[model samples]
Target: MQPIFRVQSNLLYQRLEDALQQGLELRLVTQGDRFCGVPIALDEEFIEILYLHVSEDEDSPEEDPYARTVWVIRIAEILAVAYQQSWSRDKLAQLLPTDAATSEVEES
Candidate 1:
């Protein structure tokens, strides 16, 4: 038998779309852990985000390289979603265009 999935509300979809449009950082909670990233795209079944990773080489612990990854996550696995209103916001601000960043600052 096929597993049943809960019907997600339109409000949730709208929020996700807004996040994708505005380059907002989001935190997603799944059954196992939490993930934080900027949304790239989404459909009924899944959402994609650019996940940033910083790794340090064991031999050179002082140097940490930054990596960006596209993470496609199943919509069904998302238990909850929230705006990352802390350091992530600051980090995303750095990634946005200067004009956009200035506009956001002016708006705020």
Candidate 2:
């Protein structure tokens, strides 16, 4: 039988593959932080992503439309990976005006 870590890695690979195929945004949790991005490439050791949002500190000062940076995270460093969920229109309609301001809190 394969080792437990190997089995878990295989599962993680499969999930990343599915996410890539579906063009789903993913939230990857690592030891220290989390990242959200669309999978651009995947391999045994790394998953590369086009970041959905780059922080100001990390953002490039030059506004070049053709320039893009791919963020690569080690598969081993990822503790968990999950697709970002979209709010349904019906659910969005139920949200109060103040809900938008509080949305960030919900994630925490």
Among all candidates shown, the one with the greatest lDDT: 1
- TM-score for candidate 1, please give it: 0.58
Candidate 2 lDDT score relative to the true structure: 0.77
Give candidate 1 misplaced runs (Cα > 4 Å): 1-9, 54-64, 85-108
Model 2 clashing residue pairs (backbone): none
| lDDT score for candidate 1 against the true structure | 0.79
lDDT of each: 0.79, 0.77
lDDT of candidate 1 over 1-108, digit per residue (tens) = 442344365566667778888899989889998888999988777889888878767676644488887888887788888884445767878989989988988898
Model 2 C-alpha lDDT per residue in residues 1-108, reported as the tens digit of each score:
433355344888889888989888889999998888899998777889887443464355646434455789988799999896577755654664667636744766
Give residue 100's error in model 1 in angstroms.
27
Alpha-carbon TM-score of each model against the true structure:
0.58, 0.56
